[model samples]
Target: MIRLPIKFLGLLLFFLLNVGSVSAQYKQTVLNKTQLLLNKENTIPLGRLDALKIAVVTPDAQKYGVFVQQLGRYADISSFGFSKYDEQTKYFNTIIVAGTEGDLSQEMLYMLRQSLINRKNIILCRFQEVGKNIPQWAPLLGGRITELAYPDFSDLAQQNMAMSIFGGLAITEGKAINRTEQIRLQYTRGEGSGLNIAKMTQKIDFIANEAVREKAAPGMVIMAVKNGQVIFEKAYGSHTYEQTVSTKITDIFDLASVSKIMGTTPVIMQLQEKGIIDLDSTMGHYLWQAKESNKANITLRSVLLHEAGFTPYIPFYRYLKPGDVQSKASTSHQTKMADNAYLVNHYYRDVMWPEMLKSAVKPIGNYVYSDISMYVMKEVAEHETATPMDEYVQQILYRPIGMKTAGYNPRTHFDKDRIIPTEHDTSFRKVLLEGYVHDQGAAMAGGVAGHAGLFSTANDLAIYGQLLLNRGEYGGMRYFKSETVDMFTSKQSKTSRRGLGFDRADPDPKKEYPSRLSNSTVFGHTGYTGTCIWIDPKHQLTFIFLSNRVHPQVSVKLYDLNVRSRVLDAIYETINEVK
Candidate 1:
């Protein structure tokens, strides 16, 4: 307006653009003390209370004790009845007084005052109304009390602020208590503010109905997590056409190729961190037989990125003849030949390794997804560590993170009822595959292979997803250095758009696997048995879809159904709509 010089105007424009970018990156909300106390903040830090002990005090200690236990999953938390207020204040660093049912006892009030004097943080929740004057702890709690005609009628005018706590739990709006009881808080701003729970529910419901109507599958389990919190999780349809048993959140599903990432990949990452394996090192470094083969020059990085020239797969199980029925001899090498059992005639390492080494290697520098690459990598990892892949991953990764249901050979640890059936194998095995692995190759590998044969529940997968989002730390323990995580997740090749062991967001928007709304930083993998794990680091989002789409038969293509991608699209659209 003042006819400023052209250079000055350009500088001003650049400054404005930079400001906008910063605002987009860190969207902070202004809220009053009361709002801050009631609402958790967005982008909550991980491992917030790792070093400190917390005690949750409530009048109904038994009732709120359940919430405390859930919070313990992420933090170290203990429950204490009001009677133990004095003792808790003496030991714990922070004390949370929840519920508004009863009047404050003088001893508890005195202890809170002393805690304030000691500069100890105290979180108070007035969830209900009591017939008494406002307690003196109101000022300490960063809020002023105003008498109302009804105790339950919270003033909406004062609810203009929001805060997030416990990593992705958000408290937003003018005191709108939406999904308040749930510990995981979701924010209400920009795209996050407009998340349509109703529409999301409807979408999954429709897909489940269509799947059943079209005989795609009898049941499905969908779990979506944003910022280390589960936003949507549901089980649809019955176990089979018979409608005998209903699917549950606790039920574990066959993960198929997802095993590559969740099982083998993590172990490899750990080995790299321990200086036991190098991505650039040749496969021949670990497998002595590969030292002389064409694969001798192939690097672990190339194999993981799927550019190692290995063929997609080999049906080695087809070569095995029917074992002697009379020889009921079962050892580590073989399973008892039964009607509903896998016929493992010999040790996989002795028989399969030789065959794998003999397999032809195609021309290098091409993007060809190959299960054989993972199979070889599995052998390499096991040989280098002197541990079986399954046992190593269990002890080093799964058990440490409390992923109880995540492991190979589910029949060993879980009950049959807890494991979902994958298929009725009529081709090779000729039996109903329940707790056993569905992949013929993995079944022949004694139910533990790199490309397939891992079972997990939605909740456990969410925990693992959160671990990655946290940059490989969970429950106050550091599993992988942040740099290692970044290295593995970074795009490795422009031509393939693949990470070390993870698949990045498709550059082509038209690709049906990742949602179009997903930014380029999102990385994940989809299993052949209707399982997928997509993580969007930019938005701190993770989505897991586990289903036995091949229950009766493995004919239905999930891509044609657009079930997974559409759900992802819907999630992003809902988040972005408010903006």
Candidate 2:
């Protein structure tokens, strides 16, 4: 599937308060997919093919070299070969045949035609350093087949053009695939959005200004999408009171507990889809270590709902004796905790896990917001998938959704400045927590945990909100099934305001995590580090907020100011005013 940020806070001050690219003149008649058939097209015979096939009609794969490289950024290319005499090559969903009529024998041409007849998407690309109109196989391919001037654009732009041409229909070959577009969402800016932009803007400005003025936090990013179109987005304040740097819209922030939904829960949902983990099954069904402990009888559904009565948190760092500290990672202590701190190897396994299993409370069937729930669930997922949670979710969710900056341990993949500072770390690892995780437990676990340790920009989180809002599909790709999304995002427990793994709007409207304006249909999670991801299905909206409210020093100013929920209420009011 192929398709197609900054902020100024001084701009609005009204009712409610809170908060959180382009290339080219080239155009293609693009759809979500070719055969899922967005616009009218004749029937296509569906195949089990998933990956792209670069069918080089010329003897050398050299002709399609640059184009194939561009395609690689969009989708994984499984095989490349000459299409001559190979009827089996048609099994692939998308095929790019690079040859003019001159290079094709009658047999190769026949194979290409058979592929088209078999409903395979074939791209007739004329390899060129500069753009030219060589209508090579346009007639045969039945789509606009202009060879783009490679020099006029970037590799990313070239990939966008290819994606626009190939479309989203082919990726249906795989369950849970990426609809790789360089741009993830479409923005409308309140035009025809039913919301009152002027009033909304004024309130938004008030929220930002108040947050900064009240000293709750120096900076924040707020973004809202309504009816599938981004209606409002803004960034405000500086990275800290020092004001040495202004926070850009592209900056990624520490997403504390939001990691539960952003990573762990998604893995559990996907694993459930594969029949790897059963929600109703006991914890012992998956993790052998839990078998001999009190956790063995706990149900995964209870764990997700926070009704398993797990401990709210365990201060694993405090338990660390002086001997547990290491100047650096080693054979015995291989986990890096922070910029200059490392932890003993198998600390979580040998220490944390045993403590969790032996804890007095097992499954009390009562809601208790517990970090241990996510920790255990993360292990359960790793145990089932045989892959680390980070790697597994990256393969299945973030990468596929066209999310640019999402995953654990931002330091490994991004520049330090690109990741906003979470805190000055007055205690524990007494250093500025920039590019390192803010949660001590997750940092102790080496920056990959079920509950916290994720870091991402607002846009990446928005894509996830859109993923759930569209009922497990986005940009024409499906991740979880509609039912899976419903079960995970809808109310699942009578004892708590929780879906399977998501935090729902509080049943008692006054105490909603987001706002009293929110209904039960809203489902998402909040990060302790002043970040949130809220998606509403009934209203067709997704709201995201990211802030390092703990920067310099931990303070409750953001909550005391009601910055997030007020902005959310402003959105609802704006929409309601128009309606």
TM-score of every model? 0.71, 0.73
Candidate 1: C-alpha RMSD after superposition? 8.6
**What are the runs in model 2 whose C-alpha is more than 4 Å off?**
1-184
The lDDT values for all models are 0.68, 0.70
Per model, state how many residue pairs clash.
9, 13
Give candidate 2's error at residue 525 in angstroms. 1.1
For residues 432-451, what per-residue lDDT tens digits would candidate 1 score against the true structure? 77778888878777788889
User: For candidate 2, lDDT tens digit of each residue in 373-416?
Assistant: 99889989998888999999988887666666889998999999
In model 1, which regions exceed 4 Å deviation? 1-194, 324-339, 342-345
Clashes of 1: 9
Q: How far off is residue 221 in model 1, in Å?
A: 1.1
Candidate 1 clash pair list: 40-163, 40-164, 41-163, 41-164, 159-174, 159-175, 169-185, 170-185, 191-575
State the TM-score for model 2.
Answer: 0.73
Shift in Å, residue 76, candidate 2? 13
